[model samples]
Target: MELHVVSHPLVDHKLTVLRDKNTPSATFRELVTEIVMLEAYEATRDILVEDKPIETPVAPMVGKQLAAPRPIIVPILRAGLGMLDGMAKMIPTAEVGFLGMKRDEETLNIITYANRLPDNLSGRHVFLVDPMLATGGTMIDAIHYLAERGAREITCIDILAAPEGLKRLEQEVDPSINFKVVVAAVDDHLNEKAYIVPGLGDAGDRLYGVVD
Candidate 1:
């Protein structure tokens, strides 16, 4: 349960635009992509790689490439879908997966409505993408599902996180999960209704213009 706050200037710049209520959906979408790319850069610092010998016109040299057992990227849908393009721009060869989840309005519980992932993620480096980690329900359920499939090394990437959510994840989940949470900003608190206070509202709605 390690935490990595991306403090780069470019990340901050992108976040400022994204947090604006006036930013159009088109621009907001692009900014989210850029920010995710920056955060993914940090989250994937320890990605496994192997050396391979290669010959160039100038000289022969050895370089590093992704190790066997290709990495997997799972984005919690619908808002998570907005981040897919950004992530794919970096790891084009990685396998893509999707997990559809929603938070129950009344009980604030996470509900998994759909999942489309390979059977065995064993020995795979998985990156879980979700724009907002306000209450931690969706992320908790997501990690549990991935773990059930044999994914041991996992990283959760988000644009924003609430303190309550981050605390709950650390206290409730085991540290050995090899989980690293990379976010641009950790907000102050969660509202009684489980929404992040002064946080970006309804990531799915903002990203896709859906009310439900």
Candidate 2:
């Protein structure tokens, strides 16, 4: 798995606030979107583009546009949905998919509650958006699911990551797959409860208030 941790002043600024425990839901949600846009810019650095010939008001010029087998954006439910608008704004034409998965608190196993994706992702470039990559069970499941569907390449966008989850991708998962992770920050170790230390708390709860 390829790993890229974005380094930008703006990203640093927003993440600092995001890490604050007192940050409100409304602000946290807004910062997630803002920070994602910056990270997405780096995540798509190698995105395929083709030359386009066009005439400007002054003269003719060649431009670039995203090539076909248009990219797909798969947001991993609830919290991930917070990042959809920001990513879609970057690639407006990119198709959207949804994966609703939850992890068991006790066993840390993943459960797939919903899925809305193309049957044949053969040759498709998929972008899976999730805010935090802690234990990585959910991400591992998502990667296998997309890989089985023939997704040629997958780029996971996360706001934060932990060493444990990143290692899981390296040791437990197939290393040859065309997969990469772009995150705003990779924080300290995970606590006993499996939460990323110094993380922005539960992303889903932070983005959308705590639930029963």
Candidate 3:
């Protein structure tokens, strides 16, 4: 399990606004979107590409294009939905999938209610987008879910993560699984309720203003 804590100035700036408890719902949502887009830049660093040479206005130039079997972007539903547009804006040719995972509040265990990804994902690169990685249950399940379907590579992107969650994932999850995480900031720990301490808080709620 590899981890990347994005240190870009732009990401930090946006994250600062996001961490502010006083940030309103509208502004928080927008900031989260921006931070995800920035993190996606690092998350997709190794995305498959094919080199192509073309004649430019000045001279011949070489470039690369997304390789065949374009990467698939799977946003674990609800909070993950907020990251889709930001990722798509960067990788327009990438295929999009959906995974709806719910965590049992009492047990803090994850349950997959829905998945619409390709059945034969062999040799396909998959990026799982979830705003917060608090306990790692959803992401752990998400990676295994895609791997079960033959995904070649998997990367998890989040705006914030908890150290306890990251460590638990490293120790408990299978080492044979080639996985990496790209996040804006890794917080100190998880509260009793399993929320990242001083985290943006209920990313879905902040984004959509819906309470249950």
Candidate 4:
């Protein structure tokens, strides 16, 4: 698995605000969109494109276009939903899918409660979006789920990640699979309770309110 941490002034500035506990949900949602859009720019650097001949006002020329077999954007439920709009803005033509997963706080295991995706993803390029990568269980399982359905390549986009989680991903996931992770920042570590230290608290709660 390859990891790319976006480094830009705008990304840094927005992230600081995002980390503030005082930021309101409305602002949090907006910043999430903006940051994701910026991250998407870097994340899609190697996106498949093909040359097509088109006539401009002056002359005919070849320009690049996204290749066929449209890429699919799959957002892990709840917190992941906050990133959908930004990714969609970046790749409007791409298809959208959903995977509902959560980490069992007690067992620290991933539970896949829902899935709505293509039955045969034989050659699809999938972009999995989620706000955080805390322990990596949810992501590891999500990747396996996509791989099982025949996805050829998968890119995970997150706002923040912990070293523990990233390491877990490296040690646990299949090396043969084409996988990559793009995030705004990699925080210090996961605390005893499994929360990322000095990291933005529960992204879902920040974006939407706390749920009972």
The candidate maximizing lDDT is: 4
| Each prediction's whole-model lDDT (CA) | 0.89, 0.92, 0.88, 0.95
- Tens-digit lDDT string for candidate 1 (1-212): 78999998898888888888898889989998999889888988999999999999999999999997999999998899999999999999899999999888998988899889998999999999999999898898888789879896989999999998998898877655778899989988999888786787877788889763
lDDT of 4 by residue, 1-212 (tens): 89999999999999999999999999999999999999999889988999999999999999999987889999999899999999999999999999999988899888899999999998888999999999999999999999989998899999999999999999999988899999999999999889998899999999989999
The residue pairs found clashing in candidate 2 are none
Which of the two candidates, 3 or 4, achieves a greater lDDT against the reference? 4
lDDT of 2 by residue, 1-212 (tens): 78999999999999999899998989988888899899988999988888999999999999999988999999998889999988998999999999999888999999999999999999888999999899999999999999999998999999999999999988776766799999999999999999999887889988877789
lDDT, residue 189, candidate 4 = 94
> Model 2 — which ten-residue stretch has the worst lDDT?
169-178
Judging by lDDT, tell me the better candidate of 2 and 4: 4
Candidate structures ordered by TM-score, highest first: 4, 2, 1, 3
Per-residue error for 99 in candidate 3, Å, reads 0.3
Q: At residue 152, what lDDT does model 3 achieve? A: 86
Which scores better on lDDT, 1 or 3?
1
Q: With candidate 4 superimposed using the best TM-score fit, by how many Å does residue 48's alpha carbon deviate from the native?
A: 0.5
Number of backbone collisions per candidate: 0, 0, 0, 0
> For model 4, where is the 10-residue window of minimal lDDT?
103-112
lDDT of 4 at 137: 93
Evaluated against the true structure, the overall lDDT of model 3 is: 0.88
